[model samples]
Target chain A: MSAVAALSYLVASVLFMSGLKMLSSPKTARKGNISASLGMLIAIVVTLTDEKILDYTFILAGLLTGSAVGVWFALRVQMTAMPQLVGVLNGFGGGASALVAFAEYIRISGDASLSVWTGDAPLDVLITLVLSILIGTVTIVGSMIASAKLHGVMRSAPILYPFQKQTNAAILVAAIVLGVLFVFDPSRWYLLVIIAGLAAILGVTSVIPIGGADMPVVISLMNSYSGLAGAMTGFVLSNNVLIISGTLVGTSGIILTNIMCKAMNRSLANVLFAGVGAEYDPSVQAVEQRTVIRYTPEDAATILESAQSVIIVPGYGLAVAQAQHALQELVNILTAKGMLVRYAIHPVAGRMPGHMNVLLAEANAPYDILMEMDQINDDFQNTDVALVIGANDVVNPAARYKKDSPLYGMPILNVDHARTVMVCKRSLNPGFAGEDNELFYNEKTMMVFGDAKETVTKLVQLMKS
Target chain B: MTEGLMISIYIFVLAAFVGVEVISKVPPLLHTPLMSGSNAISGITLVGSLIAAGEGHGGLSVILGFIAVVLATVNVVGGFLVTDRMLKMFKKEPQKKDQRA
Candidate 1:
């Protein structure tokens, strides 16, 4: 039975790896998902077949309940709310691992007199169980808070109060002390409850001070926490397969998180210890802004026709308007007119990392045409025109020069450096962080105010004419 | 087989089945977030590894467990930090408004 289980796990792991690899590219991602799901199905069937359980009722009930809820969430949750839902699911995974460890510990404790059980139950098992519970509880609560913030049920800005940091420190100390006590007295079940409560509080407090803008990172962090808990539980059970899979997930998540952090030009310590994304008024004076160039669709088309090089920068507005395909069409037309067409993708342009890339890839935009911020920012200066569709903070020059701006020191698309710039947006409202964008009023920039898709569509038509 | 082993197998089966179904419905837009978020959940594996290390009475298991715990911790902490950093970019208002005019 163990042999069969091992084989099944091996197959599942292979499928998981392949699925993850396929996920890197959009074209094959769906097929990759299906393949992975099939592998999981096999794993499930094989594991169930090897089980000696006769009481299927409770197991079936659990399966049904979980599936029902999972299906409902998968279907009903909006794409915007998916991050929070993912957080909730991550918490559940941690909680489940913790519960499994607890149950195993309880069983071992119940049969202490049995030498066979005593032989199998090592001190390592007890340690793993406790650690899994503690970390699992923390992941659950922390992830829940992250979900709430993403869903807009809680504040997006860092929820900092006077002495909030001090209180968090105190809670950490208390939880650590409690964890030590639990390790010493495994028989005292109440210690487990206490540790769990303290850990949950720790998780919540850790994430509470993190601002909404930092949610993706927080969510990633929580994901790493849950993965570690799973691996620890696997260690307790001596489950090699679980350890391998858990480690893979844990490492990959960390790497991806690091990539994201680099894109934002922030240190990990600053993100974790400092109250990042806290709302503060900018000290920079609002320049008496003047639009030097306001172009109708026809005028923008005329400029595009004469341009030698054009760089298109996309933002969340593109996603909201579902304008990737339309933008792709526009890109094609410009390319045919002997203009050099490329996309300038800021690392943090949309709601998450690679957001603009994903949107563009979905539209079958050539990968070669999509340029990173660093790669294309310098070219913007030499380019004839920089066209921004629904992007804001990423194009703002304030990040480079204005220390008082909320986006100070952050990397931007350098669209302002272009010879000519065209911006398409619906309104003058501030972005997610509520900081004013300075690029909209630049001398070389042209404001083409409308819905991104509609405006791009009109521009495409004018260009065709 | 022992009832515990049987139950464990059953749990694994159920979890796998459910996990596949849930992941299938996830849209492309939510993929990165879900992946990052789920990675955090998976970091719970570290807690188990940490416990294993503390409980190990002798040399080999303890050493292995400790290494696993450290790696897992790195994964968790680094991953979260990176993720939060990435999210900071989205928090800023597009400064393009000034350039537009």
Candidate 2:
């Protein structure tokens, strides 16, 4: 039975690898998902029916109830809320890992005659058990907070209070002490509760102060922690497949986090730069404020008609107003008119990483036309019109020069450099960074203030006529 | 270390290397799905949850086990469903293969 289990696991792991590999490209992505799901199904069936099972009722009941909820969430959620959904679901994964590890230890403790139960846990089991509980609890708490922020239930800004840093420090010290105690005396079952409580609190407090602008990194980092938790749980269970797949996810998630951080040009030493924007710099005032120029959609159509090329810079507003279809239609009209149209996508463009791609793809926009920030940044200068759609901070020139601004030193698309800039936004409000964008005041930039979908729909109609 | 621990460690190191290598070139366009899909992979604890739920060692263990099972199932089922939904959203550029859900 063990040998068969190992074989089944090996087959599932291979499928998992291939499924993930296929996801790297858009064309094979759907098939990739099907492959991975099949792998999971096989693993579930094999494991549940194995000789270890004493009762099937709990597994089936849990499976039915959980699937009903999962399927409902998957089908009903708006694409704009995908990040929030992912955040909460990842929390569930972590919670499961922690609970399983805790329960396994409890079961072992129930019997004192067994050597493994009577004596201290071997070093490997002890370390992995602690790690699983700590990281898993953190993932659950941190992700719930993150989901709230993304869901707009909580303010997206960092929820900082006085003495936040010091209190967080105290919690860490307490949790670590409890962990050490658990290591020495395995039967102090109550200690698990205290340690878990501290760790969960640590997760919440740690993520609360990370501003909304940092959510992409936070989400990826949290994803990595969940994976790490799973890996640790694997050690507790001696399950090879869990170890393999969990490590894969853990490593990939961290790499994704690094990619996002680099895109924002952030480092571990970002605190030093936090004060860089505290003092109002003279350069911020240097921009000569011009009376805002608001253009009608008809006027935007006229400008776009004469342009040889156009680049659409999408932001969170695009998702908020569900404007991807209208934007795509406008693009089609321009494309038919022999104007070159491409989507200039920032890595962190929407609420989550790769948000714009999913939005545009849902609109049936061709995948080849969507260009990454690095790929399309240089082309903005040569483009006839850089159409800004509801994006604010990412296109702000302040990132390049206003060293004291929160958005300072971040990489932005050079949309301001384009020959003609058309900004389709709802208002003159500052973006996620909550600072005025100097780009709006530029001579070449014109604000067409309205709902993004409404404005884009108007543009599509005007251009078609 | 015992041979059991040694084998596990060996598997851990090699799998980490392979995992790193496997995810090397994921395009930026797939980051959301990548996050979602990895969340599902971490749901491998569903097996552990099953054992705990069936072990029925005590009342407290049974309750915790049931919840763990549900959570793991959600991670597995929900993650894949959402990921597939997102992946299916992409309208391919004149693909030779039929691209229907």
**Highest-lDDT candidate:** 2
Identify the runs in model 2 with alpha carbons over 4 angstroms from their true place: A112-120, A268-289, B94-101
Report the number of backbone clashes for model 2.
2
lDDT (10s digit) by residue, model 1, range A131-216: 88887788888988988887779877887778877887887788677767756766666676677888888888888888766676
TM-score of B chain for each model?
0.69, 0.86
lDDT per residue, candidate 2, A122-182, as tens digits?
8688778888998899999999998998888987766667787778789988887888888
Residue A184 of model 1: what lDDT?
Answer: 70
Which one is best on DockQ? 2
Q: What share of the true interface contacts does candidate 2 keep?
A: 0.74
DockQ of 2: 0.62
- DockQ of predicted candidate 1: 0.06
Question: Would you estimate the TM-scores of all the predictions?
Answer: 0.74, 0.93
